[model samples]
Target: MTTRTSHVDTFARDRLPPPQWQPEFLFELPELQFPDRLNCATELLDRWVAQGQGERLCLQAPGGVRWTYADLQDRANRIAHVLVREMGLVPGNRVLLRAPNNPMMAACWFAVMKAGGIAVATMPLLRAKELGQIIDKAQVSHALCDAALAAELQLAAAQHPVLREIRYFHEETPQGLEAAMARQSPSFDNVHTAADDICLIAFTSGTTGVPKGTMHFHRDVMAVCACWPRHVLKARADDVFIGSPPLAFTFGLGGLLLFPMSIGACSVLLDKASPPMLLEAIPRFGATVLFTAPTSYRAMAAQAGQLRIGAPRGGSLRKCVSAGEALPVATRALWKEHTGIEMIDGIGSTEMLHIFISADEAHARPGATGTVVPGYQACVLDDEGRPVPPGTLGRLAVKGPTGCRYLADERQRQYVQHGWNLTGDAYIVDEDGYFHYQSRTDDLIVSAGYNIAAVEVEDCLLQHPAVAECGVIGVPDEQRGQIVKAFVVLREGHVPSQAMVRELQDFAKRTVAPYKYPRAIEFREQLPRTETGKLQQFKLRSV
Candidate 1:
């Protein structure tokens, strides 16, 4: 907190975690050394437009919707004007953003930053109950929601009046954002905010339990641009990025919007991103890079032979990125077998903002999550908080240009210890510095005193021809204390039967450790997943 804050409404800054709970940040790259007074929105958007890139294509939406850099800036600047002139927004005010991955959603997000307001983006599918929890937690002052998704937010605001104002986007109603933007001028003077001022509060996926608000600064957003995309991604200025991850989540926010914009590239936003929809949209939109979870990659791999993925082919597509869960060895190999383009697997959390441990196709090992991206340092730690030798499974701890900063929560002590961000992921770093993800620390299974990683069993299950998707969890048992159980969704033609379960169990025994086989197998039509496409094992344990 050495630098003076630019926040006029200082609720977010006032509620920041205590000094001792904040993790240490490292800015090794020149790009990370942001000036004391900075605004990320200007760095990502306004700078490019100023550098004579205004006419270049910047954002694309479904149904042939497209916006150049100049167009996006004009829209965002107008919205920023509306925020100040119409909505009565003040710097540092928390504003809720609710919408799918589209051009309008992106404009609203940038508008908040340009206006010096703290943006709290939420998943479009979040129900009234979940939305209310976030509003109360952040004391959100205003919201800009899509007309189609306004029902849930309206219901949430009724119950949680801490949310002061609500405005819909897209619709031409008098109170809608579009109508308000029509009245404001196109040009706006961007707010001067400190690099350390809080600009965004991203909530966790609530995979473990209650979601915590993770606060990130204006410089933290720019810091990621220097690390992952510059070092690991090596994205081209001409690349067109597209994915299914909602803009609310950091994964999608970086890949679909920030990363592309940083290099004057174009990004395509999808309204409907199912496997079939994505398969059709990828080629139709000529998207070069694809970002999604491993499950989605597995589904798309089934149709890879029929579609055209780039690099070796004539298609524009070239790279595929998988995150939000461990990338099974089977899924990685399948995509390469069908498309001739190796999939890039990485691990990141909302707290860290974007991918920290990742590798390009050239440096990526078969099943590893790859080395830590440049400008960041990671180590595997034992239960006593000491670094362990390579190849031993332990907690993954990282210190980098960006780290976790929970909003005034006591649990902040657990996330940051001794200046390191403990990501709660169990990983095994090899001698060559490649990190192999085992499972979530809490997801570790202890069967008969022998600890086993559920991801290993799930990876083995995925190799079977009949299994389409699966989630592995430890269930209580009297004999072994806890046994590994796998819930599998069979392929379309394969019917659920007793014989099929036996075959899959035997397949697991042959793949890895003989004792790691799932003793209990349950057939499911579909596995539960969060909006970001992460498997919700917490729900599985409850079931």
Candidate 2:
């Protein structure tokens, strides 16, 4: 790929991994082809208006505020003017965006991309210390945050000298970005950026708790849309997308904003999307596609009565996607039973940009994570980075147009090896070519010379009626080197007692291998989880 003239100095491009370490990119698919000079915002947002789709609805907010493609394009252009003329934002300069899933957040994201600036969107729940770390690590110079959620960023900016300017939006005050944007021109030209220009820097937490910045290019954004939504998702232009994952998360960024807009479709944004809120929003907005995690799906399945009001009657919700973590077989079955929709289980990460392994409704299996997405190649590799035989558990390695490019992080070498991105997942591929997720490589527990996948054990425990949530880990034991220990959160009516523990153990034995049953069971009010709702197994291990 040829590097085009970047308006601002390309800090992220300069920090990319060495050429040899980069994965082999594939753009042979007609949909993946792009021009040398391209602006993603122009393609995703502006083109819809230029092509006579301006009147089409683009965004639906919880407050009943709707935006057409023309409205979204005008706001994005005005925000771009604010970034360049008022905020002194230069191309390639990193802009930290902190907001929930709303129209303004989506507009600001496109504005940053339109102005040739890299967007570093953070979750609203991140604390001051975490925000400070991201600000320092990304060398962020400016921020566009929701005025309601600006407290933590204010505290973070106080400590980080690199964060020179902070602008609040969604506020009626004169100092807010929204007010500033209103005064600027609503017509601005998109920056002529290279197809490979870094447009986003997504931060993800590692096992050590430090955040790693994953740099993605404008082409990558378009690549994921072409590969996943075009082939697997197969969403129509009339589809209405809605989801619970925060827009800061890549999963939500793609599903809620990018993918929907790529096809001229619309999306409904909810600032607070709990399970109940999601259930209520579906029929309220006439949502056709849903994106969220498996845990949320499981909770909604348990409360099926609440979902019936806006449920799957008349094919209102044609698709349901589950990601962020592995979708347990039990959760998938329960959700399918409740909604008559087979939950599409996918596995994507900040490093990979979006879902590269998934199946449509037809090819989906109960427990399998589907085949490698089009334009990507995946394989199960052994310790030496060589492909393992079918059905043998090993590291999951994938290579495609989009791959890991850590921003000046040493872990880059560990993540990408020999031109293949080594996803830190333990998986087994069956003869039919479906990937079965066993566990994260770090989550595998070994006890008495047996390698036990914590996910398998947790799945078994989840089948018991008393278990609401569970985390399994290997704890030191004098007798067996290590023993499987389960920290469980019981349902509302269930009592945590010795009898319940015995019953859970017996249930696990009947569900999975006897050796995989939890030797020690500890009940908890709730399991430790990250802001993104992933189980923090390391925290459970310490307990």
Give candidate 2 misplaced runs (Cα > 4 Å): 305-312, 443-543
RMSD (CA, angstroms), candidate 1? 10.0
| lDDT of the candidates, in the order given | 0.86, 0.85
RMSD of candidate 2 to true structure, Å: 9.8
Global lDDT for candidate 2? 0.85
lDDT of 2 by residue, 1-543 (tens): 486557575777788888877777777788888888888998899899999989999999987799999999999899999999998988999999999889999999999999999999998767676788899898999899999988888988999988987889878899988789879998998889998899999987654446789999998998998998899999999999999877888899999999999999999999988888988888889899999877678778756544653235454788999887777788788887877788788988789999999999899998899999999999999999999999899999998889999999888888889888888889999999999988767754545434466776787788888889998887876434467899999999999899998999888775554667899999999888999999998898776
Consecutive 10-residue window with the lowest summed lDDT within model 1: 203-212
How many steric overlaps are in each model, in order? Answer: 0, 0
- Per residue, candidate 1 scores C-alpha lDDT tens digits across 38-116 of 9999999999889998999998887779899999999999999988888889999899999988899899999999999
> Candidate 1, 197: how far from true, in Å?
0.7
**lDDT over C-alpha atoms for residue 135 of model 1:** 93
